[model samples]
Structures are given as C-alpha cells and as structure tokens.
Target: QLLDIARKYPDFPIVLETVRECLQDVYDVPALTELMRRVAQRRLRVVEVETATPSPFAASLLFGYVGAFMYEGDSPLAERRAAALALDTVLLSELLGRVELRELLDPAVIASTSAQLQHLTEERAARDAEAVADLLRMLGPLTEAEIAARATTDAIGGWLEGLRAAKRALPVTYAGQTWWAAVEDIGLLRDGVGAPVPVGVPAAFTESVDDPLGDLIGRYARTHGPFTTTEMAARFGLGLRVTADVLGRMAVDGRLVRGEFIDDLPGDQWCDAEVLRILRRRSLAALRAQVEPVSTAAYGRFLSSWQHVGSSDSTGIDGLAAVIGQLAGVLIPASALESLVLGQRVRDYQPSMLDELLASGEVMWSGAGQIGGSDGWVALHLAETAPLTLPAPAEIEFTDTHRAIMETLGHGGAYFFRQLTEQASESELKTALWELIWAGWITGDTFAPVRAMLSGPRRSGAPAHRQRQRPPRLSRYSVARPHSRAADPMVSGRWSALPAAEPDSTVRAHFQAELLLNRHGVLTKGAAAAEGVPGGFATLYKVLSAFEDAGRCQRGYFVESLGGAQFAAASTVDRLRSYLDGVDPQRPEYHAVVLAATDPANPYGAALAWPDRAGDADTHRPGRKAGALVALVDGRLVWFLERGGKTLLSFTSDAETQRAAAAALADLVSAGRLPSLLVERINGVAVLDPGVDAERAAVQEALTGAGFARTPRGLRLR
Candidate 1:
C-alpha cells in the first residue's frame, strides 16, 4: 500500500507516522543539511524556522536565518555581541539604507517591503561601483565614462585597456582590479578602426545586472527549496540576476518550491525528490565512511590485543579465552560475539579434535541469516596429529648371508660350529661374527668352543715309548735328488759347503723327515721304529745321529719333535744377508735378531738368548745347537745363519723394525701391556729381556739418541 501511494503521487510529500517512542530517531545530520541547501536554492517557499522554539537562534543554521545572534552561545558572549553590532551598524546599514525595526518585525513585511529593499539594494550597488571606480583611479588613470560604457558593453575589456595604458605610463602595475575594471579587463576587445576604438564587449560584463533582496530570496527558495526571495537576498545581499541563476540550478535539481516569499526565511515547501535523493546518497556515503574506518580501527586493535597471546608460554583454555576476549573487543558489530567465541574455541583445541567440534556445530559465524544449528558455522574436523608406528624389529630385512647364518644359529638357543654358512668372504664373515658378538646377539664365549674344535683335539696321557724317535731313512732314488743336496751330511762337524750332486743318505733322510712333519704332521714308520730301538744298527744309528746333530730332530720323552719347515740353515743365512742389505744401522731393532736352537732337554727347539742366565725361574736350555742358529729380525724379514757348535755367531735386527718396535714398546709401557724389562743390544743383537745392567745402560743410551726417554720399564720413544 505504501509503494502504491508513493507511485501514485510522486510529487506529494511523504508523511510517515510512528509511535512517540520512535519519533526521537535522528536523521543523518549531513543528509538533512544537504537536503535543506538544495531546497533553498530552488527558490521554493521553504521555511526552516524554529517551530518548536520562539527564537530563530534555536533553528538549525543550515535552514534558517544566518543572523549574528543565531550563532550566540557557540562563541563567547562578548564576541557574539561584537559580531552582531558589526553586522547591524556597518554591513547592514551600508547594504540596506534606512532599515526600520518595524519593517523587520513583521512576518508579512518581507513580501510588502521587498521593493524598498530592492531600491536600497540598487543604491548600495551604485555606491559600490563608485567605490570601485575610485579604487581604480587611485591605482592609475581610469574614466567613469569608460567604466559606465564598458559596464553596458564589456566592462572587463575597458578595464584591461585602462590597466594596460596605466602600466605603459607607470613603473608598477596594480596587483588587483577594481569591480567595474575587472569586468572590462576580462572581456573587452577593440575593432580595427583608425585608433582601435572599442567595438563590443563580452557578454559576461555586458549582461551583468543588479539583484534585489526579493529577487534573491525568490531565487534561493526556487533553486534550493521553497523559500522567500527576501530571505536569500538578505543573507547574501545578491542582485536579481545572480539570485535567478541560483534559482535556475535548484529548479533543475527539483529542489524549488512555489508560493509567497518572505525576508530571512527558508521556503515553506521543499522538493521531495531532490531532498530524499540527496539524503539517501549522503546517508550511504556517511555510513560507508563511518563503517570502513571503524572496521579498520577494530582490525588493528584485534591484532594488537592478541599479539602476545599465542607465545610459547600460554596454553590450554586460558590462552583460548585471552584470544577470544581480544577478538570480541576488537571486531565490528556487537553481533560478532558468538562467532568470535566459537571460532576461538575451535582454534584453541588440537587439530585431531576439530572434526568432532565441527560435526557437533560448536563453532560459527553470526552474519548468516536464518541460521540453523550448524548451518552458519565452519567445519574444523581434521586428521589425527599423532606420529605413525614403525615396522616390527623381526620383520627388518638383512642380506641373504646374514639370514642364512642367523637361521643356522636357530631361534631361542645357541650352538657351536667350526664354520658359518654365509655368502660373505672369509674376512667379512669374521667381521660380521665379531659385530654380532659385540652387539650381544651372540655370546663372546661361543667362539671358544669353535676355535678349539678348528684347532684340533688336545693330546693327553703319556706315549708307550720312552726314548726319542729317529728320523726317517731316504730311499736310493730320494738320495739322488739334486734339491736335497743342501741337506746332505746335515749339520756335520761344521756348516758344510753346497754339494755339487744330489744329497747323501743322511741328508736325504733329514730332508724327508722335515717334509713329513710340515705336510702331514707325522714321521715315517721307519723313523718311528728307529727311535724305539735303544741301540740302533750302524746305518740307522748313523742317520739318526746326523739328524740329531743337525738339530732337525730332538729326543723327547715319547717321540722326536720337528722344527719349523720355512727355513734351512743355508736359506736362513741368505735371508740374514738380505736383511742387512738395506737395514738402517741407527735403529735398535736393526741390531736385534731372534735365534732358535735345539733344546737339549726338550724334543723341540726354543728361542735362545745370548749369555744364558742362571738361577732364573723361567730359564731353560731348550736347545743344544745354540751356535748353529742366528737370525736378523727386520720386520717381516727373518734371516738365518749357521755356525759350528761353540762358534761365536752374530744376529742383528732391522733398524726400521727396531724403531717401530721401540715406539710400540713405549706405548706398551705406558699402557702397562709390557713387564718392567730392558730393551738392549748385546753383540749387535737387540734383546727384550730382564738382564744385566750393562746391556740396559747401552740400550738406554741408544734410545736416548733416537728421540726417546728412559722410563721405569724400558726406553720410551717420545
């Protein structure tokens, strides 16, 4: 019905009735002010007076009289009074002559006394023109006739010509133009005449006209609103044409009113279309301006408020509450309260719990219309935040070889074996097994049984025989082999020269026995049988005697013991010569060598020390052929040489090997890996033993010269 009424009477005023409680709704201030201005410019009979108050001072300044007293109470009382006096005494009297109080007192006086005000307005305009003329003359040469003529034609043109002429005759030009001079100077032009006399003036100066208070009031009311022309003219003191122009603009915007006019009064009728349109536009603009700034300010506040809330220390509900409070206080529109609270709650919990909250519709935004329980909220359910479980230890994969070995070991129990079934090389297999033991997967003692088994059974009980065994006899064919020549007549009275032919019978036998012991770990039956007989046959006894003399076999309680197969006396001597070839003479190990001699008491030979010790608990004469064995120990080089029984033999160690050994010995001393013993050289042979003081002193002096210090245990290489 309201729409139908509004459409039916578009030009009619809109009147909405509401209860007294709603009457206090204040319209937008800027909207109302713009509407009032528009209405007044339309020259309408719009009267925006203080209907509720008796005095015009109570009226809104935008719509009512702009009198001095109207602005009172806004400024100091004295200032207000001074302004009012100036307006009345100086401005009002000069602009409107002989103004009577009675003329201003009547409401109808504006309509009737408008002509008198108009005449006074013309007189005042004339006086102003005269004053402008006087001002122009003072500045330079200016004529009244020229001004009057220009005023009717092109006043600005005439004025400009006059100004140009004055400037040509004077040193300085006036900064500003007089009233009539301005018009002439701006619009006047001259025709092509004998002296270039003025032809026509521009329309701006020629068409200029005087305006009266009534005309101004009428124009103001028509253009801005429905107001009396007397009011506009009194406010602005404008001429008729200027007021009409203002009226034209207001009328175009539909802000004018039609009716009787009054002085210093607004139009009684207003253009509903223009005022409402302006009010709506201004209201929207104001609302947007106000809302945007508030939103921006609120956003800044929200950020600042919660800046410290999410730091490392804050946790749980307290942190959530702090953030929620900050958001609520800083966001726009009080309606955001629930949204902020719910959002903050959801954000505070762990991500894994989000789905539950979302499914239950525990969080939401409030702006949505017709919101159901969960309709307006955002879903926050998320995946679990816990770390994933890893695969089982048993399922871990290993190499085929490792798998095979582990499988062989069996589950839950252990077994001892000589070999492991693995694809790894021998070295790798050893390493892997060691690693397993270190890792506690296998027992360290497990190797004991396996090592024992691989090494063969231990011997027990005494043998049936009591005498030492004789070496084997060589066949006629073996005796004739050239390779055995070196062993012929083995270790006779003295070291024999190299033979030109195959070895003799005794040499062949000794060589055969050595080969048997090295390869098969057993002596020939003949050799064994020969040892059993106490007094051998001559040939058997001679062969056995030669073997024994050569240190190739020894008399044990049960049987003969073979010596190491790597060296023959000749080869040993050759190795000793090689060691000496490049050995550095300065190193202690260079002068050190090891000597092995047949034990006169035991079946096997023992390592020998020079100048044998007596009464030592660990000392024993392991060999009888002490003079036959001499060697140089040079790192991996082992050199051997033979000397006849009772002959003096020299043995030396490689210098490099001795240095390395000394350094290692020093470390051993520091680590307590070695016993307190001296490392010394006796007769050019390095000896590591607890011995005579002279030997110790000699070794200490050598070590000190080789960058070593004497320690309690031995010589230490620094």
Candidate 2:
C-alpha cells in the first residue's frame, strides 16, 4: 500500500521506519557526504515531525518515489539534510527553533561542505592528468579505452571530453578508434609519417566561421607575440601541422610578420603585423634615446654614485680603495661589484681591482660550495676580517696557482670551489695544494666559513661617522699558530699525504669472502669465479687450508649428505680455523689467508701479528682486468662484464628515473666518485628512446650487438 501511494505521487513522506532502514546500510563518511550533497541539490529532502507511534518523528521526503503530501493530509516537513549531515539537528532545532535560523544557515558550514567537494574534485583531476601523461609517454599514442583503464576516476568519459573541450590533449582517428596523444607528441607523429609539408597557410576557414584562424593568431600575437608555430601549438594545445599552416596563411595575407631565427628557440617566429610595426617603432625610439646625451647635472650624479677615478689614474689603486669604501662590509658578486665601480668605461676591471686590493690587504673573495668559486666571486671588506700577527721568518715559496688563490681570496674572504676553479684548472689547483695539505700546513677543511655583514648596535655616545669609519673585521682563523711537529705522529712524509685510506687487497678479499660465506655457507664454483679480481678463487682455497691447520675452520668439496642444518650448526670460527692451516707466508695467498684467520670470532687471532692499518699505508693493487666497465649502482661503483644474457627493458624517455640517470652520473662525476678516466671508457651510452618497442627481437638483437643492455632500472652500455 505504501509503495502504491509513493508510486502514485512523488515526494510522498517516507515514514521514519522506512527512512532509517534505508540509511542503516550507509555507515561510511563518503557515502553519507554524497547523500547529503544530493539532498542539498534537492534530489531529496530530509524532514522531521512529531508523532506518537515513532516517538520523535525522523522522516525524509522520497522525491523520486512519492509526493510530499498524502491523501490522508499529513503535515509537510522542512528541508534540513545539510544540518543532519553535519550534526544531529533534533536537539538543536527543538532548543533554538526559528530564534537561531541565521546560525543554522551559517556561511562557514556551507563553505566547509563545498570545500570537501572541491578537494575531492581536484584530487581526481590531478590523478587523471598524471595517468594521461604517463600513457602518452609509454605508448606514444593511446585510444580512449587505454586512458580510461589507467585513470583513477570512474567518470573517465566525461573527464576526457572535458579535457578535449579545453584543448589540453589532441585526438586523431586511427584504426577506427579515436587515438589520444599529448600536444607535443603530435608534431613528432606527423614528422614520423613523412607528411608532405604544406606550401603555405592552407586557406584558413574559407568554408567555416568568420576569420577564426585570424582571431586566434591575433590573440596569440597579443599575448605571446613573436612566438613560433611549435610554441603556438604547445600553448593552444593544437597540432603543429595545422597551426603552422594557418600561421603561414596569415603571414601571406600580410596580417602576420616573421621574426629572426634563434638557435635556442629552434625556429622562426611570427607576430601580428600590427604588433611587429609597434615593436619596430619602439626599437627605433630606444636607439634614438641611446644616442642622446644627458645633462651635465645627470652626468655629475652618475660619477658621484660610482665614485669615478680620473682617466690618467692608470692603475686601479685609487679606484680600488674607493670601491671598497662604497661596498663597505657587504659581500657581493665580483662582476656586479666591478660593474658598479668601473661603469662601461673600463675593461678587465675585476682582475685589475683584485690585484690592487689584495696587494694592499684591503679586501677578500670567497667561492661557492663548501670552499668557494672558480668564476664567480664574493667580495669581503678587509676591515671586516680580524688582524693576524706576523709569524717567525720562514721560507714562503709560492706557485702561480698559489698566488692566484691568494689574489682570489684577497686578504681573507670565503670562496667556493668553482671560484677557485676560475683562477686555475681544478686539477692543477688540487695538485699544487696536495703537498701543503699532506705536510699538515693545510687541512681538508680548507673552505672558509660563510659570514654575512650584520648591522651594528646603536651607541649612545659614539658619533655615527666615527662608527662608520671603523667597522669591525671578522677573522678567518680564530688562532694563527700552526700545529707543533710533535702533535702529528706521521711527520716523515709531510707534504705528500695520499687522498684517503684504502683497505689492503688481502683484507678486502677476506671481508668480502666472509660476507659471502655468512650469507651463503657454501660458495658455488661459479660464485667464486665471479669475484671482481682475478685469482680470487685460488686465494679462498689457500685460506681454507690455513684454517684447517689452526683447527678453527674446515675446507673441502661439498658432499650431498651435508644438509642445510649441518652447515648452519657448524660454528664459523671452527670452520675458519680448520680452513687456514698449512698456508705459507711467502705464497701470494698468505696475506689473504692470514687476514681471514685473524677474525676475532676465530681462534687464529695471532695469525696477523701486524700493526693496525694506518691512514697513509702503502696502497693495495687489485688484479682487476683492463678495460673493465664501471657503472654506479645505488651511488656505489659496480663493475659489470655483461648483462648475464637477460633481455633489456626500456622505460619511457620522460620517465622520472630515466631523466634522473644523467643527473645522477653528473653528480657522481662532480663528487670525484667516478674518475674522469672511467667516464671516457663508457664505450656505448644508452639513449632514451620512448617510441621504440622493447619486445621486438630484432630491436633487442640490434641493441645487444651495439653493446647496449637494458635492466628494469634503465639501459646501460657494457
């Protein structure tokens, strides 16, 4: 009967029992929010009433199913879905009633609900955009179905239609389905197909709306005027072929003008003819203004601002002091400071001023990075650097590189490595300083501390002019004394210290062997053979014999009956001792065997009887094969001979990982991790080719033949 009544008249009041029953299924926040939003849109109305059977009446108007009024004359309920969604309204409505209608309809509540809807909408949009971008990069061109499959939202059809309407992506009819592609890829596809180039702007809209092409061109010229057809296509989200054709027509019609070709821009540009004419007029006026002379008072002001020295001053002695005074305690780029002091009238201004100031102990310069710059310079006032007392007379022999460094730093300013790089070749500077550093005259922490000029406190009695005349100087070194000879234990080879401590070849082999054994108790023949250095397998065999002599380790060929539990139960120390016996000190593997046996866990601790590895110990030479390929994996250098015959996979050219590979290599190269020699040895670098198919056997064969190999992470060259 209730169904019949509801069917007969829409908006009929749904009884509290029926309303609660329907709502009982929806307990989630998302579902309730969606329900409330629908109600707010008037898809349904929430209502309440006073009734005895149900007590406090809570009912809803089922607009789609029934009428608000009944044939039996039931009272109509007020619309209040928003209030119910946010909070229980029965108590508030009864307590306040119409007295607080304004509070009930507060803007804050309305905005809060709207904002949630907006946030969900934006998140969906961003996800869809990312999915579309990924699909285009991986597949080159994709049909609507492919995009929908990857999209995050269910309304893919509507979202795609919206994107099309907004001209954010292009669509083409291919193989009977609409194929979508990124705007930039459209140009590549047309070129790849070898389409005949249009002779001129193919008659723009002769059969369509009035001068739509002309209007678009005019608008583009007005905003991004003097832009090429490629740039226009990208900005407007149109195909380059069509955009170029239309632009050509506008040029023929004298409605558009072409601009000079720029190497960086990669093409000729177009502008509305009127815009071109306006630009030409402006350029001509600017030229005229350049030739015009300023009044004497204006000239005087410029000279005063620059504190210009006389032309016959010859040397920068006068100019240097004046420039320092103008700059005061501030640190500024050498170029900017030079330009300000010398104006356009001087050439070779920076080097000239540097010589004068540094010789006079009036200024300092700093490089970028931890140390400071090779090309760029940061100037510091000598007044800001603390005075240093003279040391006992000692020979101070200086190389050209050393002199250049002093001139760069001047009296005592911080500089970056690149700034130092500007004074001399990075390698030369490193080489020249190697001796001084090794001798302990200089330390690894060579870069000066970065200090900025801070404003001084206001004084009650001192004159402002006097304070300005005597600014405080910051000291580069807190204490000027060099460490005493007794302080350094390794003073014999001072001035030629090696770069860093490297493990002995024997010790390193022992460490790697131990790690392998711990991870896998029994090393297979192939695993032992695959060690990076040649003859490592024989060294392991010798070490096993010595362990046997010491009764700390065991060594023998694997037997079928030796189960996994047997290996696990055998103590590593007992095995090592049994394995290290009968090793000769004169043999090549003696050091390796001895090193492995001396592990604290093993009882052969007395095997070495050597001092702890020193910081400047003689370097160990590993028997690595020549021409070995070195590649960085997870920021550590790993040598790879071949790809183990696995098929190579290629990712999209624009994939984040692929793009970041070059940057990673550059970073490693800069950090001195990858030597310059190894960078040159990279025989066949992999090029990112997104359009190529990886599954093709012929493609794989060709890549392999050319020394290229692919891994899941990226492509590599052997």
What is the lDDT for 717 in model 1?
A: 40
Per-candidate TM equals 0.15, 0.18
Displacement of residue 568 (Cα, Å) in model 1 is 6.8
Compared with the true structure, all predictions reach lDDT values of 0.31, 0.37
Candidate 1: what lDDT? 0.31
Q: Please give the lDDT score at residue 248 for candidate 1.
A: 56
Where's the lowest-lDDT run of ten residues in candidate 1?
A: 383-392
**Model 1 C-alpha lDDT per residue in residues 158-189, reported as the tens digit of each score:** 44445445432111112122222333332121
lDDT of 1 at 662: 42
TM-score of 1: 0.15
- Point to the candidate with the largest TM-score: 2
Candidate 1 residue spans exceeding 4 A from truth: 1-611, 619-692, 712-714
TM-score of candidate 2 to 2 decimals: 0.18
Off by over 4 Å in 2: 1-207, 222-224, 261-266, 305-718
